[model samples]
Target: MKQSDQAVVFGKRKEPHTIIIARGSEIRHFTVRPWMAAFAGSAFAALAIGYLLATSYLVLRDDLIGAATARQARMQQAYEDRISALRSQVDRITSRQLLDQQLMETKVSELIERQSQLTKRHGRLGPLLDRAEAVVNGAKPAEGSAPAKPETRVELPSPAADTQLAYAAVGSAKNPFALWSTRNSAAQADSSADHADKLFVTLNQSLRTIESEQLARIDSLAENAYQTADVISDALESAGLPVDADFGKADVGGPLIAVDNPSMFDTKVKELDEALDKLDKVKKEAQRLPLANPAPGRSISSTFGVRRDPLLGTPALHSGMDFRAPMGSDARATAAGIVVKAGWNGGYGRMVEVDHGSGFSTRYAHLSRIDVREGQKIATGDTIGEVGTSGRSTGPHLHYEVRRNGEAVDPLRFLKLGKKVGQYL
Candidate 1:
């Protein structure tokens, strides 16, 4: 056994003692240096420092990890709030779209109403215009049987209310007017498409009708011209004048009529021929005659003469012609003129004064209704007023007066002149 130089403490020791131990074959020595105490204390302090450093590093890492987790949670919360805001915005946008759809539906309803009225107007006008054209052209074939008069009463459709169509589909409004309008709009669209197709078809038909009418007119004129030319040529041949020759190259004076013509027939014929040529020129120029009924259809109620008044036993000088017609009958113009006055007069009621060109003027009196206004240009045969028994009139009649250069003139001469014109003006 080896003995160590270690001090052993005894509970009953009175003095400090050093104990030594010896070994039989070997000795073991242990020395403690004074600097070793500092070394040992330093080592113990270093170990404690190392342990503290490790613990601090672990704690700091844990704190940093916890802070990072907390920061991530905050960012996630902010993103969730932003997502919620976006979702709210989307909800608002969807609500706006629904509102807009309702507005569009309202607008569509209004448009449908307007479209219906237009269609009705077009229908009435289209037929009226067609009839007017037919009458004017005299192109309709005569009917075999008497025609039945159509009912003149016309009914028009009204509009729709907003409350009636709030819940219905765009076209399913319960209102009769709305339903009719929607149907009419669809029908009109179909009709418009059909009209476009039919317009081409109708255009072709109208073109054919116009061409036929024009061709008929041309043919009639040609036939009349041929007959006239033939008659002229035959008459010239019989008279020993140039036959089958153009009028531009003809001579009538040398030997055909001779210097001794007792009847003066050749001279009259020449004059008549010249008059016919003038008439042809007038016809080509679309000249209008004085009136359709040149000698007005009314009865000759009064003449230009002195007459005794019915009310008073006094003589009065009548300066114009008076025509008696049914009250409210159309009173056509005597000639193309500008209406100078359309107002009441002292003795003549509802007088219409017209200023015809070439220093000529006319006056119409005792009218029930004045059709033409002052300063209006009226064509010959156009209705200027309606006949009636007005102030100073014996009965339903028209008092017409003719004036030339502002002087009262006899109307009989003008009536005779008007009679010479053709029927159509």
Candidate 2:
């Protein structure tokens, strides 16, 4: 091959090149080899490519940043929405819980009120029962009658039962949010709500039980009062005394005024209270009635009715029954009354007349000594005089008379009635 051709095809040596620039009167020249020129071209190409890449990057920077920022904003919005949903759920749960709590509180208040009324009723009945027990068990003997025998008393429940019932009925509901601190979710809220509902149901059932027990107790008391009142009324009728008009069924009034709004249990309690009040009134009236024998441990010497008078020795109407008693034996008042007459009378000496209420009065005649004065208050079994023979009396004895509106009735009737009443006094 030719040398030139060979050099061109496979050059092993560098070739020189020159560049010349002329401007006005100045000239510059640069010489370079073929290899150096090629290197310079390669460097220029690399710089051009780098510049293009730098410019393209600068132009697209804002779009890239904008796209990234939009993506981040969308993600943040989605997170905020999720948080708002959770907050809404919490709010709903809280509102429902508040409503439930309010309802429970209202129910608790009602139960407490019922318990208070029941307790008050029990308090009133307790004393009345005690009084009845005393009356039935500690009865004093009637004058000129055998002593009363001791009786067994029915046992009553302890007062602590009432206190326990009050505590249970007034108990507060458990906290509905008790488990809120441990977990916060719809499931947790639902669980808490269910627990509250169950608690309220249990509390309501307890209140109902308490109310039932109270009603039963009240009914028992009312029954006892009714029975006692019936007995007292019969005794009063036998003694020829008028029973109180208020005790009649027609005179029964409405329920008592309540401290709060009335309920069925309250109405029942009020009725029981009214019955007890009537029974107590009857008891007091019975105490005031003349139903006791005037002379104790004595036998009737002269019976009331038509009989031979000891002084006259002829058929005469006996105004009173004469009790055979030792001289100077105590003569007690037959009833609680105010003494209206004392000292001597036409046919009797050292007599005492007691005016019981309700147009009833009693007289003790032929007494050796008068212990009671006029206008003096005396109770049953109070010493009013001393038995002796005086005036028209033939022996040491007491003449006792029961008068209704100043008219003498058979004294034996009252003495018999006294004997019957003394058994329950």
Candidate 3:
């Protein structure tokens, strides 16, 4: 290489020269330079860094988008569950409210009907009481108390059904609350209320009908009683029973009636009729009771009074009569009564008791087999049991007793009375 001339190199390996200048001497050194290799390495590093950055950014973006989608799906599912629960709750509430409303309406309607029936019953009471009082005061039936006018008859029409009632009501359709959020959507609630109202009205109507029917029945009974009373009064007159002479005369104005006289002449008659009807009903009930035996042929073995106990050999008060009978003989009732007891008793053993109205009672004891049960109604000469030696008895015999208001009475008295009333019964 020339020392003084400047040399230029292109695309060629070259060494860098180091020059040292000293006061006394000069030194020079040459070293290889790799500038191109270093430049290429720096460029490759920059490109790799850029690629890494781009890949990292793409990964982050994908993760963020996936996370967002998952969150949205979860939120949607949660919202759906909440809406379903709300809808179910709303339906239940509506149904309950409807039921309550229906029940209330039914109760109200029933009360109203009952009130009407009671009012009607009371209206008939005033006249009945007045009639009864007059009859009790030894007065004859007053003139005009019974109608002299001809009986007015009314024809009852057959029941007719309403076309609207015949047709079934169409129920309302169901719609989702979500579709009309602002509007009330308790279709069940409204329907329930309407149904309840209808039920209440129906119940009320039924009660009213029943009241009317009952009133008619009462009227019929009253009419029959009045006729019976008239017959009885006529019979009494024929029998020469004493009667008030001024019974038919109105008190104040020569047959003119007084206002608000609670005690009208016919009022007493009405009361008497009602009383007679009640008595007749009782008699009919007694007659309708089932008979235990058709024929009365039981023999009397002992009389009711003081006697020695057959089993204990002690002096005891005999509260009842005794009838000797073969084992398994039928024990019959002496009168119509309800079975008060039909089982084993302390001393009597296998006893049956019957309670007649007005505190009268009869007992049959020492039976082999009980035929009647408690609460069973039995008429005169009705078989109540089979005879046997049961408790505190030496032989097969029926122990018969008569009681009045739980107190023992003479059975013979009752027997005599039974004989007296036999024809009428």
Q: What TM-score, computed on C-alpha atoms, does each candidate reach?
A: 0.35, 0.57, 0.35
Cα lDDT of model 1 by residue, 1-425, tens digit: 12232334323435433334569876655555657767989999999999999999897998889999999999999999999986775555444434444554554444454435334544643454343233223221122322222212322223243223322333332232332234534344334334334433443354345334433333333333333333333333443333224544556543233355533333433443443453344332222223234236667877877887756869988877788688888888877889999989878888898887656788888888898899999887788989987778778888888777788776765565344323212
Model 3 global lDDT (CA atoms, 0 to 1): 0.59
TM-score: model 3 vs. ground truth: 0.35
Report how far residue 383 has shifted in candidate 3, in Å: 1.9
Q: Model-by-model lDDT, in order?
A: 0.55, 0.73, 0.59
lDDT of 2: 0.73
Clashing pairs in 2: 15-34, 135-425, 144-295, 144-296, 144-297
Better of 1 and 3 by lDDT: 3
Residue-by-residue lDDT tens digits, candidate 3, 275-374:
5654454334333322122225767877888888776889899998887788988877777879989999999899998887666677888889998899
| Candidate 3 Cα errors over 4 Å, as ranges | 1-295
Clashing pairs in model 3?
Answer: 128-271, 130-267, 130-268, 131-267, 131-268, 131-269, 292-382, 292-383, 293-381, 293-382
Specify the poorest-scoring 10-residue window by lDDT in model 3: 162-171
Prediction 1 TM-score vs. true: 0.35
**How should the candidates be ordered by lDDT, best one leading?**
2, 3, 1
lDDT of model 1 at position 154: 27
Ten-residue region with minimum lDDT total, candidate 2? 148-157
Residue lDDT tens for model 2, 289-404:
77787887888888888998777789999988999999999999989999999989978877899999888899999999998799999888999989988888778999999898
